[model samples]
Target: MSGPWTEWDHLLKVDPDKTLVDGETFEDVCQTGTDAIAVGGTTGMTEEKMATVVEACGKYDVDLYIEPSHSNAVVHDDSLDGYLIPIVFNAGDISWVTGAHKEWARLDDDIDWARTFTEGYIVLNPDSSVAEYTQADCDLDAEEVAAYAEVAEQMFGQDIVYIEYSGMLGDPEKVAAAQNELDDATLFYGGGIHDYDSAHQMAQDADVVVVGDLVHDEGVDAVRRTVEGAKDA
Candidate 1:
């Protein structure tokens, strides 16, 4: 709860592999009053694609972050405020938890440790691309979700605990269970936040409500409403 993201109540996640709604530009998305913009995707991510989105987003006066899915897709730019590295606590494979991170750290000496922070993730959607790619266990109940949150903050010492449902809206009870366990770690909720009510519901328990497909599917105006919903919560 003590960094640039501490005050962020809303974030717009742009997938490099996907295009924005027709006639909508990065400028439009960035000006929607979201606390920040996070660039990332689960699949088909490449350095070229990442750079394209980052360059476009860097033009606006907003906090810009790269949520790198793989080492090769990472884009280093002066405009970037930080890197939000995901460590999936429920991934069946070790690679998504720490293996890839170790490899990235070993090969890259230019890493800015100060600007990089780890997000302990609990992927809770069995149908999502991230769960499929990482082989994450997504069948946990509310109590189990709370245990993971406790482990993320007390055991792993992660500053952020993300409940990622990805393509669908998550259960608010489960999100609240996780929130109850966290004393300091920022709780981030991202999934099917397509409108104001969905965003506000999740924002009630989450420290930050992140909207992804909303911008690409519904455009900037939809994202603007979500920003208001999250902040207003």
Candidate 2:
């Protein structure tokens, strides 16, 4: 059940809550070396705001995808390549795991299942927006993280296993543990990836490295370094 994401090794996740590259537009972000442009955010996500970013990225040749944080934030357009829906596997509240998904399915009848790819997430950033929103349990150790990864791929039939350390950098040991447990699922590591070294190291331990805040903070030249590190790692 690999989706469009399988073709991309490095994804530049543009948070709708944050501004684009200081002076550059979404088009510049796509052309700057990112394998794909993922439009999403944990808070303040709306279809109108997402559409602006999508329309900008659509101007480029890169693949465009949406990671909708809420059902109303989803946008339907020819520019969208697919949707990357994250199911918080370790969320303290059940809504993150299934309730929200049920709402999306019930509200949006036009959802193309073939274009939808679900990532089982273990959100480990206690202070991050997503963790707060979902009330995720961020206290797991390496063994627990590995177990979550196994359940995601084996029992849940997930295509990707995401270890989300949203506002902070992740531990290599934990990432390696999750990678070791997965036999075939793509491992995605995101959070605190701001430079080439971090991106390279994570890329070595995981299948993909998703960068978000970096593009918003340091701009595209810095982002290009990450793209190179992720692919050439």
Please report the candidate that would top TM-score against the real structure.
1
Output the TM-score of candidate 2: 0.97
Per residue, candidate 2 scores C-alpha lDDT tens digits across 138-194 of 999999999999999999999899999998999999999999999889999999998
How does each model score on TM-score?
0.98, 0.97
Q: lDDT for every model?
A: 0.94, 0.90
Backbone clash pairs for candidate 2 read none
Clash tally, candidates in order: 0, 0
How many Å off is the CA of 195 in candidate 2?
Answer: 0.7
* Model 2 RMSD vs true structure: 1.1
lDDT of 1 by residue, 177-200 (tens): 999999989999999999888999
